[model samples]
Target chain A: MFKDIADVRGKLGQQQYIASEEIGTVVYLAHSLCKPILAEGPAGVGKTELAKAWALSTGMPLIRLQCYEGLDESKALYEWEYAKQMLYTQLLRDTLRNVLGDVNSLAEAASRLAQEEDVFFSENFLLPRPLLTALTSDEPVVLLIDEIDRADVEFEAFLLEVLSDFQVSVPELGTIHAKHQPMVLLTSNNTRELSEALKRRCLYLHIDYPSQDAELEIVRLKVPDLKPALAQQAVAVVHQLRNMDLRKMPSISETLDWARALVALNASSIDEKTLTNTLTVLLKYETDVQKARRMMGGGDDGGRHGRYNR
Target chain B: MDNRVVEFIRGLRAAGVRVSLAESVDAMHAVESLGITNKEVFRSSLRATLVKEHDDFAAFEELFPLYFGSGGPPLQSAMDDMSPEEQEMMQMALSALSGRMQQLLDWLSSGEGPSKEELEEMARRAGVEWANSPQEGRWVTRRMLQQMGFAQLEEQMQQLYEKLQEMGMSQEAIEKLMGVVEANREALAEQVAQRVGQQIAEQRANRPEDLHGSDLMHKPLQSLTEEDANQLRKEVQRLVMQMRSRAALRRKRGNKGKFDPKSTIRANLRNGGVPIELKFKKKKLKPSLVLICDVSTSMRAVAEFMLRLTYELQDQVARARSFAFNSDMQEISVTLSGRRAADAVTQVLYDIPPGSYATDLGNSLNTFSKKFMDAVDGRTTVVILGDGRNNHNSPRIDLMKDLQRRAKRLVWFNPEPQRQWGTGDSDMLEYYPVCDSVSVVRNLAQLATAVDRLLTER
Candidate 1:
């Protein structure tokens, strides 16, 4: 849908997703080349958000599959609806009796039954999961496999065949190739190393934490009612906290959450009391909160209150 | 695909980034669709196709500027006017250096190894002072290229350009010469950088031993300098990962011993009891480990190393609890439980200062029995890391006997040499009889072997 890199950037911006030139170029290439993209980074850097924004910009349906440890092919690709098949059997009893009425012998009845066996395993009885749905859709889609690192190695190996061929094989229904190839985006949090074979078949993009200017733009975009000065101070404090040795550093989403919280409290700017009260919004762990508190108490320039003094 | 792109891919592979043939083709297609006029788009296209991991991104960034960014301006482009006499003089000067310059370029482009004498001669001609310091060859080659008549060439070109302008030559002729000179300069610089990079790669491939430090596995821990300790720490991490994978493989193989016929039949009942879905017996659970380490000054390095290894291997065990002591015992499982391995090691070191008191194994064991005995059970394997040095205060043989009775087994890792046991206040002999097994672990290799045995035996 994009004419060039600038077109991609502009469209993503129209959807309220601020993309760097690097992201724009990669998205354009992946679109033109008809390849899957593997996006790896720390958590909450908008890896999943990028796919949603792409789907919105292009006006395509988004099919999402959230990955976990025991995910398997039957869950991801397709499964037979056994209960539906059983109900169909009960409803078709009169029809089956009519079809076999002319047959006299038991073998002749069994042969007649075998002739219509494909009815139970047709498309109506086959339930397509995210992978199969994306492949079989008449219109192109945006398929997002989120947190792929949580999936087992066996599941990853299974994904290799689907991603490369854009087709899935059901034992009953033969191989089904994509009618309109969907744009695939797989996001990982680096929980485990993905297989090299899977990585080789796809484009790779790493989205790190945004720069200070980009982050300030994100804060303003996310929490628009907040004053510019308060947003800047909150971003500056988050930047400082990231530099410190904490168990879990605050991600970009946390920064936005903190900014929104500050705006809700009717605070004009960040100060010691405001920051201390809203610390939980930024940090998840008590140890981190205590550390941030100690850092504030040490009065290294009188903590967040120092911003007001400046 | 352009040959320049192929050469850039070669450079990337040499720098330890794995770029497969399919990826290279993909990169070519990407670059073709998105033309190379825009620098940002071109770079991002290649990066998305060629680089896979986060660590390889740094290597890609370093190689990009050297390969694709070399096609820009040279120094002489800024000076574009010269007089007739100065132009003549510049021509004569270039003729004088032409032969040696051609020879240098030929040697560089030959793709054959040049001797030290030839390299030194080239440096001398370029007016680069070859420093005797042991620095990287790439840096030295870059310095030589900068010093080589590049600055003089710019000055001479400017003088000649002005001299030609004053003598009424056409603007087009002077502009053409300027472009030629600029192209030549860039080509020379690129050739030099490529040669130096190749030479460095060759040297590294020739001597692989220099990459890893000298025999870190067998080096005595007590005598380790800070650098040696850092290297050993990295080695220990690698060793721990290998041990963990091996244990996991064993567990996976052990899980297939016998099939549960009941589960198989019940699971396949939907398919008319043909037993399509066979279920095997679950693997035996891995035993938990409780480590009691001596963190006094004498045993600090080895003890910390052991703790780091055990913590890294925690995934292979059912559960792991760590305790540290100098003169008294402290259960540190809470401190080290959920943190990163490096961070946990740092926290343990900070929490337990290396006390100056003599090694008091007896007192530490007594404290463990009195306070943390509830942590011990028949399923827990107790690993005691110390030299068994008690300073002759008390051997604590009775406490050792008690621990052995309660735990499944007691394994003692003595950092001191075995021959030195029971001599000079060492208490290994007294504690050896009560312990189920005793191993002398003076270095990382020995420690790894002992740990491997412990893991496999379980």
Candidate 2:
């Protein structure tokens, strides 16, 4: 429904999510240029969800590559189908015997088989991975390269080549350019600095947490069935949780999850008893729970407990 | 621009021939007076504008030839009648220019060429531009010449053509050479111009273009911009005001607390459980600070960093304060101020009545404690700056002990030699002990560590 970058940003802002200008630019790039957006943010902030939303908005299939350390080209881009390769090898062995090929030295036969492109790395045997699949898909696709920072630098180097030119080089199949270049989005959590060479090729944007009112609206949007009082309490409590010195602060997704959990409890107000029972969903860490409990005065529900008791 | 006095001051600042404001102004004046047509006159004017420090002689040597000696200025000049040494330099200038231009051409053609004269010159000086090439392979050099944003090169080229006419090159040949140069220049200039935007984009893309406090504080993402200095000054103001409030509170501690009769009776009632002692512990607000800063030339890119830190401490710390020097010694703690931290710092080194020489830690510690020892007390903590380059400065242990003896805790933070310490002028060895803790502080990471330790102890 959005006409342009401004429109998209305005629409999102109307939803009260407050997409940063950078995020708006990237969303515009992905939608207008039809490039797969690679979103890299810390766990729980909606990097993966952007792809899903794009797919939902456009009615396209969302193809995701959840990147991890040690992921190589075969797993991420493409691989030869091993079963087909073995079948071809068996057929060649049977036919070669009849064709009087066995008289040649085993070395020569092996070399000949290796040299035959069809017998070696062939297109029929090519198992298209997310990158290749995104390129080859007949329909529009959202290829999400998630958590690329965790991927090895070598993988990043490999990705840079594909990103610069939406073409993958296969020694056997020759170069494969995307039939319709999918919208490419690459993300990083900025755990380590990206190389300058790669940075020059792509348009980049960084996403930060939304403001308090925006976050409250997000909770409402995600869980409209939850009581208004409970939603407000959950947002307030989560906002306070974020300010604490916790190892992993509660992210927006946790914010929604805790709201949903609270709503399921049929709690009209967030009493100390209900809070203690449901604290696990909010604070993932034991130390964080302990710290929160200490702030709450050891679950004693002190004299001035009207806010907590609702 | 022609004021000899202003020029002299700027010249000293331009040491190593790094172009400064005075040079730019002079170049602009030369363009205004002589017209851009006389290449030799223009080159001479530009060179004269920039020639300062002894180190700058090399840069001038590189740029002068490229500007004036590039073409048509033959072996036989009116200088042919002058000194033999003058003639040799002219010959060297011509050949160097030709050779450098050829290298620039080759770099443009191959898209990957070793830094020719043009690239190297631009990289060294701020305003000079021979060619700008980054990333996207060689394009038509002529387009680059036209598009490259540097007006200096264009003005210089106009001078070159005008000088060619003066040198008696035929109009036809001049036109042909101009055509060739113009084509290559335009091509290269366009590419370079495009890359200026790309470089800006690349800088933004690689880092968070906007920092959390970017709008408020104005800290630039890459190089330290004027914005960073302004924002730092703003932050320093806020911090100083906050510290002033805290300091005011510290001063009024006892007077603010009048005896409460109800609390006194409550305390006496507690003695019914046989508690006898009624004691009033004075609210002692201790103030101390330790600053360790990076002063290496590379770190000089963020030279304002330490100045800002010192400015912050001037208000934050309640002290009889002490500062020691490195590489060499001077305590300018009294000179440094939070309000004018950056300028005051620059003023101290380059503008103070008695200017500071190269840093020397050994001499500084001995001098500071010996000269300013009366200022340090049980309430004080020592702050030292420099790369800890003892730089052959003697590490007098006895003086360090005497200084350390005056303070409750000695704190030394070295910007280098993180794990590997006590090498070179970093005689962290001599001062490591008399101090309570010594940290090899580098960047924000180390600063965070030092701040943590200071606050935790507090």
Query: What fraction of the reference interface contacts is present in each model, in order?
Result: 0.71, 0.00
Candidate 1 CAPRI assessment class: acceptable
Q: Which ten residues in a row have the lowest lDDT in candidate 2 chain B?
A: B71-80
Deviating ranges (above 4 Å) for candidate 2: A5-25, A34-42, A82-84, A101-117, A298-310, B1-458
lDDT of 1 by residue, B138-205 (tens): 56676766545454666656665676576566677667666656665676666565545444443432
Q: Provide the lDDT at A206 for model 2.
A: 42
In order, the interface RMSDs are: 3.8, 25.5
lDDT of 2: 0.55
Docking class of 2: incorrect
Cα TM-score of candidate 2: 0.43
DockQ scores for all predicted structures: 0.40, 0.01
| Best model number under DockQ | 1
